[model samples]
Target: MSPDLLLNQENALPWTERLNFARDIARGMEYLHERNIYHRDLTSRNCLLRELPNNSRQAVVADFGLARVVQVEPNTQPDSPRKMSVVGSAYWMAPEMMRGEVYNKKVDVFSFGITLCEMIARVHADPDDLPRTNSFGLDVEHFRQKCEDCPPAFLQLAERCCDLDPSVRPWFSDIVSITTAIIQELDSAPNGKYDITSRGSSIRRRQ
Candidate 1:
């Protein structure tokens, strides 16, 4: 019953709407981390967006059925050696979760990377487009193009978010910093417009 499921129906949104949707999702996850809550389930289906009366957007993390409170005991192991439960969608699950290994908040970071990629894909492809088969199989070309007129810092931050090593992933605070910086730059850009032609040319060169 999440609002994301309701809003993200087939053929439901235009590309610009999808972009704003992804931004709000990133903000919601950042908020969760600010409160020290790890939303173990961060798939697209679990994010709900609410429209404010001021014509702005807000999002919330929903479906906490798989969420866990991260313990902060230094060098302490679970009292029972039982394997941690594996939950969440297969495509979005971090490698450690798939292996049933005990992990910390970084697992959620990994899943966020996947979610970011999925959101980027939705910006270019039809809603009915098939899911990608692998991480690298994502449409980096499309993303790079859309970001062509965007500040370079924004594209770099998005790439860093998808880094393979969880240890290297940016913390929520870092994400907030980068996102805020980029938003400022975007706001200051002429007409809040980007050069899609340059983006398309860049994609062609890469291909």
Candidate 2:
């Protein structure tokens, strides 16, 4: 609760910097998944944003209260992360988790998709409308259309991440790759500089 704020429409990040939001969060989640940590509660309220120079921003994932470091059995498949308890914000939760099924890190991917949608849509999420089983078709399409600057691949990735079936979701590493590629492409594009500025601010480093 250190950041103590949720990203919402009133405080929505500038549209041009959305890619930074995607890349930074994806990178952080990739690190956690790489080390076998699952952040069960992944939401805008659990993410912190620090202003940076050149109108860029850094997003940090927080709130690990429901997080778990799955322990692998000697003979178990490496990809089969054991489920502990049904935990996580309902709106961002995967269908498997809602069903109380033992699942792997894909649940985080489902949450990531919801978070990404929030970033692009620039609105506070309502959990009641977010359960994975409810078919977020309308919500997803609305966000997709609203994100004029967002790449098609990015939107596609978000939808895939929120797939009802956990097994169908892509890995965090794959998310990192796609986000990184999109960021690079945007950075190299001449017309992509719209709304970006040199704010002369550096990230706040807490001791």
Candidate 3:
């Protein structure tokens, strides 16, 4: 498991770098889904970061243990199971998967959204670990959600990704576009500042 960003970076990465990591994961998911590949187990622990110069990190999606190809089988039955047995880490598991309902690549989108919370908070995505909502779903924009440490744009996209209805979740392709736009906006801004929680950053939330 990735205990923290960069595998073992003593200091927490800047907010922009964390956002870059999020983008890289989104691109990786887009690549897999484009070819009908389903990464059944998507989580921060499965994602590896290759350190680059100047504190930048390249996020690589690893651990394909539960990966499945959603290809049509010649002799498959119409109702054959497509990994509906509730696989993946419990924390990152999607609602459909948790309910043991038929699911698809959209499950990964849900995991991605939860992973965003992990990225922002540097904490586990388990329920009530951090400030959350009474709603049964992950809603970063919820009035009670304490995701203020994360970027508003990132939080908004994560909210969409975590929609309880799989059909409402955006595809990894759409996620790529949104992350690209966010990175662009960050770059174009004049000396932008962000809330960096913990790890001796400029912003720290005292308990």
Candidate 4:
């Protein structure tokens, strides 16, 4: 098990760890998507961690029990992917998935958003609190009131991942670009360290 993944503690997760925790998963998912494979179950537990000597964790996406390979062109519908029962974890399900509508790989983006929320909160998620109905994704209000301690850009990425319109969600390729930018910015900061426990001072809203 990945110690870095354990969030049920007294202190906030180190800010860098948030990006570190998610970076590889995004990469792995991106790679899978490039090959037209999507993991239907994308919870945190599906990720395996390699603990480094320096205590940092390296994430590997695992458990392909419900995965599917669709060889179709972009923005073009593939064969039916609908299932009889609601698939995926309840807490991380996209709003469309929750409503039993058609879903696609963008569902993984939604799950990533909730998974990031769990990482920030340092506890198991409360499904009731996840975005619902027409209000999918974190708005500026959720950012200021609920996730002030998380990196604004990081949470912003999550927010974009959770957009109600999957068309609006960034691809895994974009997810990779965003995380790389965050790591670069933090690496250039004074002392090159971000205090995970500190509340975020500013947020870059998505335009």
Lowest summed-lDDT stretch of 10 residues in model 1?
198-207
Regions of candidate 1 where Cα sits further than 4 Å from its true position: 1-23, 74-83, 123-152, 191-193, 196-207
Ranking by TM-score: 3, 4, 2, 1
Q: Rate residue 65 of model 4 by lDDT.
A: 88
Cα deviation of 17 in candidate 3 (Å)?
Answer: 0.9
Indicate the worst ten consecutive residues by lDDT in candidate 2: 198-207
For model 2, residues 1-207, the per-residue Cα lDDT tens digits are: 122233433344443366567667888888998888889998767888887796656888888999888776888886784657998887677777878888898888888888777665544557443323354322565555556555566668888888877777888788878877766765554455323334311111122
Over the stretch 46-161, how does candidate 3's per-residue lDDT look in tens digits? Answer: 98888789755699999999987777668975324465557888778888788788878898998998888777666677675633444446755442255455567777887788
- What TM-score should be assigned to candidate 2? 0.77
Identify the leading candidate in terms of lDDT.
3
- How far residue 35's Cα lies from its native spot in candidate 2, in Å, is 1.9
What's the TM-score of every candidate structure? 0.66, 0.77, 0.79, 0.78
Ranking by lDDT: 3, 4, 2, 1
**Candidate 1 similarity to native, TM-score:** 0.66
Query: How high a TM-score does candidate 4 get?
Result: 0.78
lDDT by candidate, in order shown:
0.55, 0.68, 0.73, 0.69
| Residue 103 lDDT (model 1) | 59
